[model samples]
Target: MSPALTAEIAQRFAAIALGHVRREYPNKPGHVLAGPEDARTPRELHPIFYGSFDWHSCVHGYWMLAHLLQRFPQIEAAPAIRALFDAQLTPDNVEGECAYLAAPEARGFERPYGWGWLLKLSAELSLHTHHAWFDTLQPLADALVARFEDFLPIATYPVRVGTHFNTAFALRLAADYAEATGNGALFSLLCETALRWYGTDENCPAWGEPSGDDFLSSALVEAECMRRLMPQDDFLGWFDRFLPQIEAGQPETLFSPARVSDRSDGKIAHLDGLNLSRAWCWRALGKAIPEDDPRRSMMVAAAEAHLAAALPHVAGDYMGEHWLASFATLALEA
Candidate 1:
């Protein structure tokens, strides 16, 4: 059987997130300072997401915790997760975050990457209807939705990089929020944007994959985005054209796992994330293939290979530990 998300693994992931979600000092701020007065601490800039090394990582860290809590409430970390949410996911804290976003210098702050993660976090919290976390976070989510609506129309081209700037990664992650919250406008916009950007793509070379600092696979992520947003039949047709050689494994790069040379270096640590996220994309896209298709088994094997290469390294180094569990949760759950 494929490695599934067991309660044991969920507990381990939750514990990892709890360990760093609030550790603010070792932060790498994605801030733009317009003046000396703009010089402020990360905690002051992002009250709810000042931990896990950076803002985007911290946002997705909370997402992993929320997802794990919902999936395995009986895990040892459940109570602590609940307590952390109760303490930090408050309206005041969310207001501070929104205010930071509204600043002129912060217009492009976090852009599609952090924007997508914040929405993903909101989507997970929305599942916990018994709590008011989602309600408190709705304003921020709405702000991001507006950002997407405003930005997607003007974004003439898709960012095909295998990194945070990748448009496909953001759209893939944000689709969950649009569907869960019944935001029809956002959903339509996302679908339209994806189709506009990736609809014509055919025979992707995938030559630049596993870029040294990449944490995502541009080719697979775009495929996953279409899988999430398009009708099944339409997505299948698009997939056939976009990656027509999957059955033959012609784009050999997508079938292979990336090697992480150094876990201690933050940029190089991204390879671990690249592996985990490729596993996520493969496992998810695998479900779209027919059972009788040869690509189905290939996808599963590829996912397992990527997971094996990276899962063991999810913890040891602070560089990866601060964020990799979220991607692991995504893969295991998929």
Candidate 2:
């Protein structure tokens, strides 16, 4: 990564952390005081349509903050980041338990967002160099893990086709936490389940018939999950079928028993960059494509274009989207 890019990301991280504490933290009238500062305020409570805690934003915040702290250790030499963390960490909010506080009377809704990401955040923060943060967050990480199994059956409700991406993300998180803590049993079980659910077969795609957005996310998610579990002959064979289409820029439809038109769902290219997804495929298949292969350059070009487009999104130290940091980090490495 160039020094300029690193510095740019560092500043973007600092800015978003500030935004989380400021614009994203205020509550409205007549709500119980869950905490002084939270993603869900009274006026701006999360819609139960997606469940509560709105934890994904918190996860994104922690991700951004951690990357910033790791790359620019001197930032923590100042006090604001720690202040933001402290403000977010309250007695009821610590670790994964924050999700529990979402009682019905208190207007709490159950979703994987709150606890899952916070657990991951606590685990990440436990390792931070800041002694005060390490002391506080390490125990939180351990506690969250201890309670993780209790929160099992994360998705009790029925899942729609597009929602597969969220489940896939959670499974990936499980794989990451398992890898971090050496708990293979849970990770393996989740991996196997995801593989079975999403894995392609002679009869159907792993997750069943999918439209454009569903196809994009399901493929991306399955490809990533397979990366963690390692390649199977079947997955490799199925992926090869799609590679040509993505390369051709007229990629055919996602998995379905009946092959559909390229313009399925109006030929919507639902997503932008496919670098992480493509990278996962490369890692899983354990076969490096030739540099001259159109797909390889296509992936690289997509990433570079994304980075260039993303740079302008930065404003006064804040990047507009959190995922851009991860993408930037990946692209710079590439």
Runs in model 1 lying further than 4 Å from the true structure:
none
lDDT of 2 by residue, 141-199 (tens): 55445444544445343233433235554555556666665677666666666656555
> Residue 54 lDDT in model 2?
32
Residue pairs with colliding backbones in model 1 are none
- After superposition on all CA atoms, what RMSD does each candidate show versus the true structure? 0.8, 8.0
- TM-score of each prediction: 0.99, 0.61
TM-score of 1: 0.99
Q: What residue pairs clash in candidate 2, if any at all?
A: 28-43, 102-108, 198-206
Give the CA lDDT, 0 to 100, for residue 136 in model 1.
91
Among all windows of 10 consecutive residues in model 2, the one with the lowest summed lDDT is 46-55
